[model samples]
Target: MRKKRGIVKRRETGIKYEISRKNLHYEKALDEIIRIFETENYRDRTINDYRRNWREFFKIIGKENVFDVTREDFRKYIRQRMQMDGLAAGTVNIRLGGVKSIFSRLVKEGILTENPGKDIPKLRTDEKPIFAFSDRQLKRLFSIIDKTSVAGYRDYVAMITMLYCGLRANEIENLEISDIDFDNSVIMLPGSKNKNRKIRAVPMNRKVREELRQLIIENQENFGEDVTHVFLTTFGEPIHHGLIRKRMHKYGKDAGLIDEARVSPHSLRHTFAIRYLKNGGDIRTLQMILGHSDITTTQVYLRYNNDDIIEQYNKATENDDLNL
Candidate 1:
């Protein structure tokens, strides 16, 4: 039995009627929002994120109806996430994005007349410098990797792929033998594997090509030609993200490089970007190679060091000497 909108449900007690205290619309609205997300082709992890955020919002809002939630309530929730939960603004924004989507969806569906989350402002984020490994640091890091063994070599190839090709962790994790174009000297990332969900071909350098080809051949010989994925564990199973991260972290530690820099998949990608720019590659080309949707992301590599600035300054003023 459903009560009309704006009419409170009541339970009879002899001659008296008491209004029901429960929120009537939360579950239904949540389900509808989830269905909408699915229809929109949102990834499973992303949909689950939205569900988690929505449930948390409901819990912290304290039995209030979804329709009655105010802008102040949203602000309070953000404050609690920041102060009590100790989340960074970037992380808070990622979670808040789900809630904001839900509010907008509700308003569009006529479930709400006005969206409280519409005017909710984004939090300011601090800019952090890109952490890229230096050439000496990379050589030091690579020296400790025991490439004589099968698994060791596989790990080596994986890291090399990231450093030279600039593949993201997820893309590398999902990489398959079919994705490699040996003759073309490029790695093809299907839309499913890429962050932007667009098919991208990343040209591989000579080192990447040789290493990847050797790894693929070794994988076929050891794990059987039926194995589809490019990288594999010693047990012949597909390599997972955690294993890759752990191995890279240990290598970073073994090389004593953790004190000054990060040694992870992202750092490898960053190192590739910095190295590419230093080698005189254009930013636009780097953007395409790295599969960045925004050119602005590639521009960050343009921020040069003091030594680079001085060298360029001296070169530009080469003919204008003060010697008399």
Candidate 2:
């Protein structure tokens, strides 16, 4: 049997423990998030981007307690970004991921029992299509590069390496001169530089091999054997990913190729993969060369439009005989 005592009075402000939980008032919530990200040793760029996105989200929703934040709040932030700012779906989606990751961390730490942004679907993004440059466009792009000078030669080699090796922008930036094995004609990418944190070797064809050799000779003669990076800037400093992108854009603009296709490092990589597959390279082998951690990611390159499908179908069935 339970004993009944005098009725307890409730505070008009809030419940007892709720006072302590008020620290999750979004301002402190962001502070806790920064600490957690730092403790996890996230990259500076990643941390900065996450912080920016959080501020953007809170600015949109007008900063309430994290405890009071609901899924609809997340939806409202996304809607405002799409409607008012006219941001691309992909851009908004990336920022949404940044915002959601904070809620996830809070849930993991027992600060919140449920993640508010857990089931928020990404915005549909079918406005523009990604594509690779045709052989003629690539040839025109190559012809425009001024390979006589050091900077021009550097750009030329960089573009060719991406076409032949199918490397990402960061991978190109991180390529060390020592990673190139002239004897075996292989370029070894260390785990630290790879997105998946896995070591992989990319084989060099005869063309890639000879071009890399020339670049090395020029690099050594000018900067000496002490310089470790495979590519350098016009000022003899380390290459940056932004500079590479801008150079690709410049090359595209100069060659009048930007009108037909998007010009970037990834496009060169896509060109490499499509050519590799069209030349009869198997999916499994292509996966290894591109350093993809999952086969499904590599399989996306296998997708073809209706026109391409019909062409390939006619070619394949054209030779087959139904003799049975």
Candidate 3:
């Protein structure tokens, strides 16, 4: 007869095991997950995030086994995360996605009988990411920099690269002199966030080309050697991200353009996309130039097509003899 408490089951094969209702399935599931990610060659950063999430989950489960974990555990995790200071809904969703991915991998590996995170829904929150700057704001930012100063020249170049070419912060920072082709007026970004390898060509607008050319000339004349990047601090080092943001904010404040809005280096890329689309650039072309993996991603800029809306409105309201 099975005992009501402190029970141990022994098999004829001399194998003894304790079968508790606690969740043990998660243990095998986590190991299988690591193997699956290793096989798939997920990015290092992604794998690190999974490991961190697994740690948090293991801590929460304590002595509980994986199979015994319920949807409630995940819900409670969400609540706990929400209670944390400075936790954004979007960020939470990403972590939740990592958790879900672990279970999914477990299911695929035949480790877990079922996926617990599958049924878990995302939390709702009202926070839209603030992106890009307006054309007027971009102009104001440029106006505050002194064209002759090293910092000013670096910033101007950075702005042009970010705004006109739509390069990411890292891409701009990593850019080498060899990345640019002065004759071709193009740049080759080896790879980026989406891991897409392609070259980007920006037909340097007259103003931007002139600014770059002048900077190059001045550097050669003053330093007796050519600089590596289109932008560099006075110390010939790459500008720090925080310094760039600070300078942008300072300029924004100086231009009296401060507002209840969030802005960053990414704003240049966003503003570029909008202006390009509004000027009738094709989605496919924009995708190639911006190194976008999908056309849908570039479509985010299409949402800001105020020019098209106004043209349509004008067309709808136009009447030659309305006054008569």
Candidate 4:
């Protein structure tokens, strides 16, 4: 009887130890999910977003034992996020995507048998049309910038680069003096947001060329030979996205352009695409210029009105012999 009682106690202790080990395994898996993004070389901004979303999730569910989380738990959490926090559908969906990614990683590593976040339906969001500055808006915006000042000159060149070349804000910030091809009147973008990651050359118009030339000359005068980047801040450091955004907003407000819609660095790129299409630039060429991997991605930049549609229809039917 004594031996049998000892045997039973040993079995209970073994089962408890196993359960504890399993719980730790689940917790470690959660940590690995966060670690995988960094190991995969995701962009810094993307990693930060993932970290924030995961932290929010862990706060609600607790950090340990993610394996026991159910699909219904995710639904409740999303509802709470929407109703309690007043997050928009798009914002909720972004957070949901991050959560789903974590589960997917765990499943791939065999830590979880299933991805609970996978089956949860994402919130619907209406796609807003891309906003671009009109010609009048552009003129007013430029007029507000103090062109004589050094900071103004740098901002002006940066604006022209994005407007003419359709470069992203980060791309503009990262540009170096070596990227400019003065002899060929082109700027070489060595890195882009495209998946293919191919180097692209953007041909500069006379106006763009002149502005870039002046920027280079001024940069050389101020920063000497070792400074590599084309754009710089007032303190001679490389330009950052935050400063660019602040300046753009200030100028927009001053010009009265901020009342209707927010003017951002991306608006210049959108303006470039709209103007390029209006001026007879083809979709395929615009795709290459914009560094888009797919022509469909470039099509979003083409905004058509009823007048534009009617004009095209009239032009096409002009060659027809139908008298009516």
lDDT per prediction? 0.83, 0.82, 0.69, 0.78
Of the pair 2 and 4, which is ahead by TM-score?
A: 2
TM-scores of the models, in the order given:
0.88, 0.85, 0.74, 0.83
At residue 300, give the lDDT of candidate 4: 77
- Candidate 1 regions exceeding 4 Å error are 1-25, 304-307, 313-324
Give the clashing residue pairs of candidate 1, or none: none
lDDT of the structure predicted as candidate 1: 0.83
Q: Which stretches of candidate 3 lie above 4 Å from their native place?
A: 1-41, 56-68, 83-88, 123-132, 192-203, 213-229, 318-324
Residue 43 in model 3: lDDT: 73
Ranking by TM-score: 1, 2, 4, 3
Model 3 / residue 299 / CA error / Å: 1.9
Model 3 lowest lDDT segment of ten: 9-18
lDDT of 1 by residue, 59-122 (tens): 8767447767889988988998999989999888888888888888877765566878889899
Better of 2 and 4 by lDDT: 2
Provide the global lDDT of candidate 2 against the true structure: 0.82
lDDT of 3 at 104: 77
Candidate 4 per-residue lDDT over residues 1-324, each given as its tens digit: 443212111231121113333453343554566566667777778777777787788677654567567887787778789898898899899898987887787677665569888888888898767878877889889998887999999999999889998888878888888999989999888754333568988888989889988988888888787888989987778987677878899999998888875699989988888888888899998999888888888987665433477899999989999776
Q: After best superposition, candidate 2 residue 129: deviation in angstroms?
A: 3.0
CA shift of 168, model 4, Å: 1.4
**How high a TM-score does candidate 2 get?**
0.85
For candidate 3, write residues 71-148 as lDDT tens digits.
888877777777854578778788888888877765665545688878888878774653767666677777887767
Off-target runs (Cα >4 Å) in candidate 2 are: 1-21, 125-128, 305-310, 313-324
Please identify which of the two predictions, 1 or 2, would achieve the higher lDDT against the true structure. 1
